[model samples]
Target: MTVQDKLKQVAESLGVPFVFEDWTLANVEIDRTPLPAVVYVLPASGELDFKNGNIRDNQNGMLAFLDKVELNGNGQDNDSVVDRMKSLAMRFIVKLNETGYFELLGGVMKYQVAYNKLNAVTSGIVFDVTLKEVTGICERNL
Candidate 1:
């Protein structure tokens, strides 16, 4: 399967309310989407490497987990909300690592939590991923 297909599978396994691809299109509807969602964007173009007449594809992508932030009456973010998002992000990372389907090209497996504007105050984690594919596979052809 393709990287996008693998990512979609991972997203579905998380059981989020929504799973979207192509952030450009999904961003327009994020405000309307229900909370606790996952979105990923993978560029169509990738770097190609040739070795001994074999080609390798390196693709870069991003995945995010979004959720509405709970706010206190004082108009401040609730600590629990932030903690929940972090916990969820950790779970996602664990799942990603467990898949064993993606071969990371480079970079460490780290995510950042950021504030986002949605229907309400939102917080989420953005994860950077790189997938490597070597040509002349055996499984599918076989």
Candidate 2:
């Protein structure tokens, strides 16, 4: 199965949709070494460098989705779940940036939302958001 399909599978099993409707990017550096500096290193600074950025689509409600996700060390209190989500969501952002798969690609997106509901014994959650275009110049994989 494709990567998107795998993500969907994970979400379905968890009773959520694999929706990355919004967008963001960060952690950029030039990599003359031919690999991202974050995961690898270069002898010289400019020889291999990198930088990070984001598209900021935020339609499926970036804030809300982030607010709902949970984290390991974060609080599990009634008021802390949102913070946990934000923290966990940031990890994806960091990973995307470190791998050089994300960067600003200017575009317009009003709102983008995706959701799955389970009304039987649990409540389905939804997120509202917009879209943002992102681009990349894959260093390791093209």
On TM-score, the candidate that comes out on top is 1
| Overall lDDT per candidate, in order of appearance | 0.64, 0.27
Candidates' TM-scores?
0.67, 0.29
lDDT per residue for candidate 1 within 1-142, as digits (tens), equals 6666666677678876555557657666677777777767646556765666655567777767777775532235644555676677677667866777656333456777656534456777777766666442343343
Instruction: Say which candidate scores most in lDDT.
Output: 1
* Regions of candidate 2 where Cα sits further than 4 Å from its true position: 1-76, 104-142
Report residue 122 deviation for candidate 1 (angstroms).
2.0
- For all candidates, the clash counts are 0, 32
Task: Indicate the TM-score of model 2.
Answer: 0.29
Candidate 1 overall lDDT versus native:
0.64
Residues 1-142, model 2: lDDT tens digits: 2223333343344443344221212112111111101111111111122335322221112322322222233233423544444343344334433443324212442322212111111111122222222332234442
Clashing pairs in 1: none
- Model 1 lDDT, residue 45, Cα: 59
Using alpha carbons, what is the TM-score of model 1? Answer: 0.67
